[model samples]
Target: MSLRYTFINVLVSIALLSSCSTPKGITYMQGMFEEMPQEIIQQSRITVQPDDKLSIVVSSKDPELAEVFNLAVARHQVGQSITNNNNMQQTALFTVSPSGFINYPVIGEIYIAGLNRQEVAQLIQKELISQNLLKDPVVTVEFMNTTVSVLGDVSHPGEYPIDRDDLNVIQAISKAGDLNITGLRENVLVVRKKDEKNIAYRLDLTNAQSLFQSPAFYLRQNDIVYVEPNNMKKRQSTVNGNTVQTPSLWISIISLLTTISVLVFK
Candidate 1:
């Protein structure tokens, strides 16, 4: 074959091979089934932890008698309107001690760490009714500092309050304005705390159907969700798109090499 024809053929073959190489990790969830396998994960309720702020409010038909059981909220009167305080249920801010106890107005020190919100409220209510302090007492418990953090490739990354007890990774991301387009859906990270130690897990969310089966699907209080950037964002592109290098520049290099080879062979 003539040098021009042979060079053109070689260039075409190189272009085809490069195209194949570029698709190695260019796509996510390439062959996922529509219906994912169902795995049973025991949904655990969020228990109280050390350093958590709690607000306990006790009430009954008589507001005067109930006043003794509850503490007072402290703050500066913002023109006697409202104060910039968190909405934990405590009339006065009560910090859970390291020993897992809080000293109440009349109940004294009550060990509450590791118990769910309902359990704590029930315990307090029982104590009051048994002691004849109040009849048909109603107790309310609030986790004032229950929050989760969203970071990395999300649209809005920050700590968000968990109004409800149960939260999932998907909802947590949604609270932070969802993940950006460049985020790697298949490599979402969840960092959780257990026994005062942090543990991390890698979750694949590209196949939306399987997100429910992930171990990290249900997030705990103070858990952090970090969505990493996809390979496209890591790439350095010039007009073509993001990535290591532009395809046109690579093609030019191949062309120069081919020209050199043709000259030597000729």
Candidate 2:
């Protein structure tokens, strides 16, 4: 081949190779977008825990009769009054005892720990009917302190309320603010309490199947979800006190090599 033709051919090959190569910037690695698992959706069940405040309201056709049973009776009052002791009057704040029982008005003590809100409500309704306190009681139980914390690489980092009983890890992350581009998908941390012990779970959102089998997929009350930033973010900020910048360094090297190749070829 002629010198000019060979030179042109070489330049074209270089350009094609460079084009196929990843750009010299933050590259989003594959295996990040995962589908919702069916089994996870089916088996995501969380039970109540001690020290969790629950709001129980029972209503009947006869409002007066319902109110009578719902009244704050002396014998059923176990915890110090939030109004008198803490100077706060929150009706839903019923602290579950270490024994898993709650001292509800008129109903006395009912064991509710390890039960879901719906389960507790149904149990209360059954109790009211069995005791003949009301003809048919409409009981509603709500968690007052169903809060989850999301920190690290989130738009809003802090505590958020979990309105529903079945909140998955991804939903919790969205609530805190969806993960940033630099957020690490393989090392998302879930800090939760299980069997009275604090447990930390590392979840990999990159794999589509990992969340399906993960026990930490279901978020519990007072659980903390943390999304650590990728190496790019670490170099940009003083996050976690580590000054490592691997992503940035890789991008710089790649960009320099690309620029040098284009100039030499031209």
Candidate 3:
């Protein structure tokens, strides 16, 4: 064969070989087909925190008394009204005071901060019995406005409702449509509010072991998950169906082109 034809044949073979090679660090290609560890499943519980709006319901032999408690709990729902009168106003959901108490009808001032919905319901049930409000009161609690914020490198970024108490980092990410390819999988950051202070935790999803040891693996109410972009994605943003690239993005583009050329030629 002529040298020119031989070079083309070799290039095509190299290209085909390179295309078949599995990318490094990909979970599917790595031999990890077993089920996740038991410890990971056990460590997925998330406790409730302060400033979390909850719906507390109480029932009793006397529905009237239960209705009173329900009404009291409903009063705690906070928000504002905007009318065509052109007036705009905003209001808080639950107003837990610095003393950790909220004013409830008949129950008076009750401490609710730092308590989960179930605990709050139990407390209210005890209060009703002690106050002679009802006999054998049954209580139920639900999070009325519990939400967590998802940001950075997700299909949809915004606050999502906390429907269940067992929501974890992976489920939260899934709720926001999972991380984009450009997202940093090994270094996701979760910001939370604890003890009237802001705290942050780093998570590594790439390692199966990290699923058990990482504190951020379980999501808390008002928790913020931020998926930083990979190095190449940080410098580029797509708008109007066009890619806007910075110096770093251009470098990555050139590197990719060079890789394609080398694999084809070799």
Candidate 4:
């Protein structure tokens, strides 16, 4: 073969090899068959914690009786008494104390931390009935400030509110626009704070059973899901933090050189 033909062949071979190299572990929940066992599906529930804000509302057949148990926002001027009208009173957010208690009206200090919304509501309902406060009372509880933080290698890394009672890790990741292709899905880290101690769990998105069985699969309030960058991304960051040294850049350079050589040889 001539010198020009050999040069072209070499450039073509390099480009082919670079193009054929595919990234592994990019697909999530690998080996997830169509017929998944019922035991593998885990139920996730959000539990209340200290520093959490809750919105509790009490309702009964008699509106006046239930109003005494519900918390209301009251505004007062310097010269006026703290007068609150039923129409003007809005449901106020109750902040859980550091000791995991909320000083609810009529009920006094109630320990709600470590309990889910349904449990909290039930506790309040039972309190009203047992204390003879309301014959037919209904209590509803909602988490006002529960959120999860997603960071690193995600399209949108920020705090996403836990709107529902069961916000799992997969849903949280989806809220952040899913992980980028350069993210290391095989080793995603989930950091959680339980009992005032920070606990970390590693989850592999490529494995279906492992992800479902991990405790981190069910994300809690203030949970942090961090997606580390893959090896190629780390190398790109180390090398001037640009695409100049990437395989695509080399392919472009080789294509340009080949075009010039063909013109000269012709």
Task: Mark the regions of model 2 whose C-alpha exceeds 4 Å error after superposition.
Answer: 1-41, 71-92, 237-266
Query: How well is each residue in 1-266 modelled by candidate 3, as lDDT tens digits?
Result: 35545655565565557547774532411223556555654544444454556555666777765676665312322357324331332222454566677767677998877676667778888888898888888877776767889999989989998788778788888899988888887788999887778999987777657655667777778899998988667555544222433344545655576566657766
Worst 10 residues of 3 by lDDT: 84-93
Estimate TM-scores for all models: 0.74, 0.71, 0.67, 0.80
lDDT of 2 by residue, 1-266 (tens): 25545665565576557547863323322334555445544556667788887777778899888876553433334477333443332344578998799987777999988888889989989988898888989987788878889999888888988878788888888887788877887888998877878899998776557665688888888888998887667766665443333445545655676566656765
Candidate 3 lDDT (Cα, 0 to 1): 0.68
Q: Which 10 consecutive residues of model 4 have the lowest summed lDDT? A: 76-85
For candidate 3, what is the TM-score? 0.67
Off by over 4 Å in 1: 1-38, 74-90, 207-210, 235-244, 254-266
Q: Give the runs in model 4 whose Cα sits over 4 Å from its true position.
A: 1-15, 34-43, 75-88, 239-245, 248-266
Task: Residues 1-266, candidate 4: write the lDDT tens digits.
Answer: 39899899988897788778886788999878855556654557888888998999999889998988777676654466665555656788999999999998877999988899999999999988999989998999989999999999999999999988878888899999999999999999999998879999999998887888788888899999999997778877565675765677887899899999888887
Lowest summed lDDT window (length 10), candidate 2:
23-32
Clashing pairs in 1: 55-89, 55-90, 235-243, 235-244, 236-243
lDDT of 2: 0.74
Question: Who wins the lDDT comparison?
Answer: 4
> Which parts of model 3 are misplaced by more than 4 Å?
1-21, 24-48, 72-94, 237-266
Order by lDDT, highest first: 4, 1, 2, 3
Backbone clashes, candidate 4: 0
Q: How many Å off is the CA of 263 in candidate 1?
A: 7.1
Model 4 has an lDDT value of: 0.87
